[model samples]
Target: MAFDSSDLKPVGARPPLLDYLVSLWGARHFVIYDARVRLAVSQDHTVLGKVWLVLNPILFGFTFYLIFGLLLQTNRGIENFTGFIIIGFMMFFYTTRSFVAGARSIANGQNLIRGFSFPRAALPLAINVRQALSQLYVLAAMFALVLVVPPSERVGLHWLLVIPIFLLQTVFNWGLGMLFAPLVHKIPDVGNIMAVVTRLWMYSSGLFYEPSRFTDNATILALFHLNPLYQILQMTRGVMLYDTLPSMEQWSLLVVWAGGVWLLGLIAFWRNEESYANERR
Candidate 1:
C-alpha cells in the first residue's frame, strides 16, 4: 500500500508565515517558562545574586550623575536632572541589553538549535523575554531612587502613563532584537559592532544632557524627534519627572515605530528561518 506524499514536507523545511506565527504562538508557554527559569538562575554564581540587577544600573546612574550633573554641570538648566539621567540610563539600558542579547541568541544557542526542531525565532524571543523580566526589578529601583533622591519627584496621575510607555518600549525592544538576530548570526562580527553602536546611541539619546540646550537647528531636532529611543526616554521623563502627559504626537510616533519595527522584524527574522539551523555548519 502506497501512502499519500502530497502533504509531506522536508523535515527542516520552512513553514508559511501564518503557520510560523501559529507555531510561535503555540510555543509561548515554552518561551515564558524558559525566560522565567533563566531569570531565576541568571545571577546564581554572583556574590550579590539578583541584587546586582537593581544595583548595577543604579551604580551607573550615580556615576553619570556625579560626573555630568555635579562636575560637568550639564544639569545647569534642567529641573531634577538627577531623576532625568536616572530614568534615561535605566530605560535605555533595558533596550541595549535586550538588543545585544537577542543579537547573540542564535550564536549562543547553537546547541539547542541543532538539537531541537522548534521555531528558530523562539531563541531571540526568549532572550528578550528574559531581559523584560529582569527589567521589572530595575524599574522598581529606578522609581525608588526618583522618589527618594535629594531632588525628589512627587507621585501623580501622570505616573500612570508609564505603564503604556513601558509596554510600547518593550515591544520595540523585542522588534529590535528580532531585527538584528539574523544579521549577527550570519556575521558574528556584527556583535562587536553593536557594542560601539549602542554606545553611540546612548550618547545621541541625550542621556546626560538636554538636546535643546546645544541645538536650535530644526533638522537636528527633527532627527532626535524621529529616534524611537529618544521618544521613549522623553515620554518616560514627562510622566515620571515632570508630572505631565506625553503629547499625542509622541504617542503616535512611538506607536508607529513599535508596530512598524515589529512587523518588519518578524518578516525579516522569519525569512531566514531555514538558514538558522545550517547557517554556520
Candidate 2:
C-alpha cells in the first residue's frame, strides 16, 4: 500500500465571507422547507397538538398573575398587569425554547446530519422557525384574551410593532442557536446548565415586572439598561404596552449583538459541519 505524493494535498483556504453568505442566502429555500416539515411533525401524534402553544402560555401567565399580581402584590402601580405579563411571557418563552431545543440539535439528529449534505445551520433555523410559529399562536391568543378579560387593553395597530420586534428577535434567537449547537455537542452537560441559566434569565429579564421600578442605585439602573434581555423585553413591552418605538440605544445594542453573534456562530458552526455527524459524547 503505497501513498502517492499528489494524494496528500492540503485543504484550500476557507471561502470568502461574501461567498459564504451568498451560499446561505441561496439555501433559504431548504431552510424554509425544513422548517415547515418539522413544524408539521412537531405535533403529529400529540392530542392537544398546536393548541398547546396557546394553552401553555396562558397557563404560565395565570401562574405569574396569581403569584406576582395577586398573592405577592408586586404589580406596584403598573397598568394592566395581566396583559403586560402575558406579552412578556409569550415572547420570552419563544426564544427560550429555541435556545434549549437547539442545544441538542446536532447530537440528536445524528442520522440526518450523517446521511444528508446541506447547510448544518438549517437545523437550528428550522427549530427556530417552528418554535416561533408555535409561539405566534400564543401571541395572537393572548391579545385576543386581553380583549375579553376585565382589565385587558384594547387592540390597535400600535401592537403591530411586534412584527418587526419578533423578526429581529428571531434573528437573535437563531444566532444563539448557532452558537449553542457546537458547544453543547462538545459538552453534554451544557444542556443542564443552559436550563438553569435560562430560568435565571427569565427572572432577570423583567418579564414579570417593569425594569423602570429599579431606580434605587445608579449601578442597578445602568445594569438593567445594559442587559440585552432587558432591552428585548423593553422592545416587546413598548409595542404591546406603550405602543411606542423602542429607544435608539436599545435597538442599536440588539442589532450589534444579533449580527455579531450570527457571524461568529456561522463561522464556528461551519467549521464543525463536517464533523457533526461523526462526533458524539
Candidate 3:
C-alpha cells in the first residue's frame, strides 16, 4: 500500500517559470484587490487623505519652478517652463515611487511572506499597481496646472498618447521595482542608498533643466537619449506641451526598454522565489 510520490513536491518550492507565470496570472484578481485596498488606505492617517496624492506633486512642481525657473533661470529658452517642469516632476515621481516602494516591498512584507505561500513577485507587483492608481490623481493635477498656468497648452489629438506612454512607463516602473526588490531584501542598505541614487537620476533625467543647454558632448547627449525616463518625459512633453507626436524612434526605444527590463526583472525576481520566504526569517 505505497503511494506514488513522484508528482509530489515540497511546499513553498518554486515552480517552473511557465507555471509560475500562470499562477501569477491566476492571482490577478487578488493582486488587483490588494492594490485597491492599499491605495484606499494609503492616506487614511493624514488629514488631507487622498488629496496629498495631487498636492504632493503640485508642491514639488512649485518648488522646482521657484528654484530652477524663477531663481536659476533654467527656463530661459524654453517657452513653457511651467508645463515642462510639471510634467517632468509628476511623471518622474510615478516611476521613482514605484521603484522605491517595490525595492522595499519584500522587506516590509516579511509578515505576509511568512504567512503565505504565494508568488513572491506579488508584493512588488501590488506596489506598482497601487502607484499606478495613485498616478491618476497626479495626472489630473498635472494637466490642470499645464492648462491653467500662464502660457497654457492647447489640447490636441496628440495628447491622447499620454495613455500609452503612461502604460509603458508603468511597465517600466514595475520592471525596475522587480529588479531591485531582491537586492534590497538581501542587503537592506541598498534601500538607503536608493534615495541619493534616485535624486541623481532625477537630475540626469532633466526634470528641472534642459540637458542640451549644459552639455554639448555627443556621448552624454546619447546617454540621455538612451535613458527610458528621459525619453518618457520628452515624449510626454512633446504631446502635452508641444502638440507634437513622438517620433517612431522614441517609441521604439521605449518599447525596447520596457520589454527588456520586464523580462530581465521577471527572471531576476523569479529565480530567487524560494529564498524569499526563508531569508525573511
lDDT of 3 at 168: 97
Q: Please give the range of 10 consecutive residues that has the lowest summed lDDT in model 1.
A: 272-281
Model 2: how far residue 123 lies from native, Å: 1.1
What tens-digit string does per-residue lDDT give for candidate 3 at 110-219?
A: 99988977888888898999999999999999888888998988887778899999999999999999999889998999999999999999989988888899989999
Task: Please report how far candidate 1 places residue 116 from its true position, in Å.
Answer: 1.0
Best first by lDDT, ranked: 3, 1, 2
Model 2 C-alpha lDDT per residue in residues 159-244, reported as the tens digit of each score:
77778777778888888888889988888899889989999888888888876675567787778777677777788777766666
Higher-ranked by TM-score: 2 or 3 = 3
Give stretches of model 3 more than 4 Å off: none
Query: Backbone clashes in each candidate structure, one number apiece?
Result: 0, 0, 0
All candidates: TM-score = 0.97, 0.88, 0.97
lDDT (10s digit) by residue, model 1, range 140-218: 9988999999789888887888889889988888888888989999999999999999999998888889999998999
**10 residues in a row with least lDDT, candidate 2:** 7-16
Task: Please tell me which model should have the higher lDDT, number 1 or number 3.
Answer: 3
Which candidate tops lDDT? 3
CA shift at 2, candidate 3, in angstroms?
A: 1.7
CA RMSD, predictions in order = 1.1, 3.2, 1.1
